[model samples]
Target: MAKHCVCLTLDFDTFSVWSAMGQNSPTPISRGEFGVVAAARLLKLFDVHALPTTWFVPGITLDTYSAVCADIHAAGHEIGHHGYDHISPAGMSRGDEIDQLRRGIEAITRVSGMEPRGYRSPAWDLSENSIEILLGEGFVYDSSMMGHDYLPYRARTGDRVVSGQLPKFGEPSALWELPISWSADDFPHFEYFRGSGLARADDVLANWLGDYDYMTKYLESGVMTYTLHPFVIGRGHRMIMLDRLLHELKDRGAEFLTAEAAVARWAAL
Candidate 1:
């Protein structure tokens, strides 16, 4: 059978960045329950389609939003650790990073009853210590590298800390790094390209759909990773756009699975 995978991951840092994007310096916390509502609705859609999703949630998000995390777990979605807070890995000391990761993992486990088997850095902001921390935590995979636009390759885990790149796979204790380029994401487009939340959402979705169509046509056996932000993809008209994208991808014979499952299966091959 042709292998096609869509790893739908929500960068569950909604509340953390909500206030900052508003008036004051991105607040120390996020208060937009709108994101929570949107995420639940999105999960409902996934349930209807029977599409398995991977939610990359920060550790603190679980504490503040435990119900949502529990609901996602109850619905059979895989939960991956994003971080303790949305702290940038590049700015932390090695020891501090390790400690942060430990707490994050424990928090997620406490809330979801599943030790995150996978990790994606907050804002894709990864560093050398990040990989070492992830390995020490016994993570099966890390999806924060951006070596190639689509292909998932491997590298030494610890080496990436200083090199600021993907670890070359070969270290016995190395974890898989799932690469999903920025070009395939909506963050940059919405935050930078269009310069307006409303226009950015629409433009990015159109771009993503175009990218998805092309990938499905040319790379039939290839994997397509869809990264959605609840604050953006979960909003008013944009939610409809996301629904259309999901259903259309399903119609095109794509198999949607959690990032953990997809990487594990791909690694085996």
Candidate 2:
């Protein structure tokens, strides 16, 4: 059977993302607070559709909203590790990155009552040591890279890329790379950052659905991952668009699965 999977994943960063950027003003923090409200709305929609999705949440967000996080777990959703404080691992010291991972894992386990099988770095950026650290800590997959649009690949280690030198590629590791892309992410489309983002819901919806249609047309079996944020997609019009997306994808024969579940099925195949 042709297994074309669709994984709907959310990055529940809440206020930590703003904190990471040093934007700790009351307004920015309040903006993050809206995510809490959005989460509730999303749960209702998912329950209505019986969708099994994933939420990659930061440790701070998890701690800040422990009850909400637990509710997400209770609703039959996978909670993947996003990071401790929404700080990207790129340019971070190896020790600091490992510290972040440990904190994130601990928080996730504390709330979800299960160790996270996957990790998605904040801001979708990874350091040289991230893959190795995750593999060492037994992470099954990482969804922070964009190596492919409709397929997952092995995470690599030991790449030697430097200025004024030929790039030496790394060896593939056991860790899976459940890739992501900017176009499929909602932050850039909806979030008003640096005075720029705010796309029409219909336009963003068209782009997202178009990607799925293209993948189904070209690939016999592939994973179509759409990244969303509660604070971004939970707005009234966008929420309607999201609901439409779920039904539309269903009509298009989408078999929605959590990130971990999709990875397991893909790996087995």
Candidate 3:
């Protein structure tokens, strides 16, 4: 039977940026700063249950909440860069992208006391230029590429197409692109603005159950990444449902691994 692995990834963008560009609501709870606290609570729950998760934090946010970052590292979770200041690589020049990635490396190393082994672009909006930058900067894997749910494939830094499912670049050729495939993303589902806010606990749970059941029935193991924002999943009202989801996954014999581990294993296949 194929063993299912669940990778929990949290995009730690502070509350300040959430309101910028009017993308998120102005509500205090919806803000990014509070999002950290929300994430911390969820982390505590995961720790109590001994579930492993991966946190892809922006450099600026990690700097602001070093304590939370430290705690996550201490809990044996993997920390990867979410870029510097939540800047999208797509808008940056090649030089600027490199500079941002370099800054991300420094920030993560300083805050977490360990150099991050992986990088995830902000908003899954990595420009073709960012891949070479990641490889050049000594990053082993990039987890922003999607469309595949079960494996980590290689993608060239500057050679990807503009659209229509970015092509895979080959392993050990350069930097590996790990897919942070989402089963349920919290920000869009919980926040009214993103159009994913209508995601109720029951609806999400049912979706996951169906997906997993199908995958299990085929004896197919795939990489499933859950995008959870602290503010959405950690809310007082939503925490119950969050815990229930975790419990259900555990009961289904799902295995949780850090992004680095997942990519490493996938690369071996």
Q: Judged by lDDT, which candidate is best?
A: 2
lDDT of 3 by residue, 98-181 (tens): 887878888888877788888888877787667767777788888887746555678754454446797755334477777755
TM-score, structure 1 vs. true: 0.85
What is candidate 2's lDDT per residue for 1-269, written digit by digit as tens?
Answer: 54798999999988998889998999999899999999999999999999999999999999999999999999999999999999999989999999999999999999988999999999998999999999898899999999999999998899999999999999999999999999999999999988978999999989999999999998888999999999999899999999999999999989999999989888898
Candidate 3 regions with alpha-carbon error over 4 angstroms: 19-30, 157-173, 181-183, 194-196
Q: Which pairs, if any, clash in model 2?
A: none
Tens digits of lDDT, candidate 1, 46-123: 888888888888887788889988998999999888877767787889887887788888988898777889888876
Number of backbone collisions per candidate = 11, 0, 9
What is the full ranking by lDDT, best candidate first?
2, 3, 1
* Global lDDT of model 1: 0.73
List the candidate 2 regions with Cα displacement exceeding 4 Å: none
Error of 3 at 248 (Å): 1.1
For lDDT, candidate 1 versus 2, the one ahead is 2
The alpha-carbon root-mean-square deviation between model 2 and the true structure, to one decimal in Å, is 0.9
Alpha-carbon lDDT, every model: 0.73, 0.94, 0.74
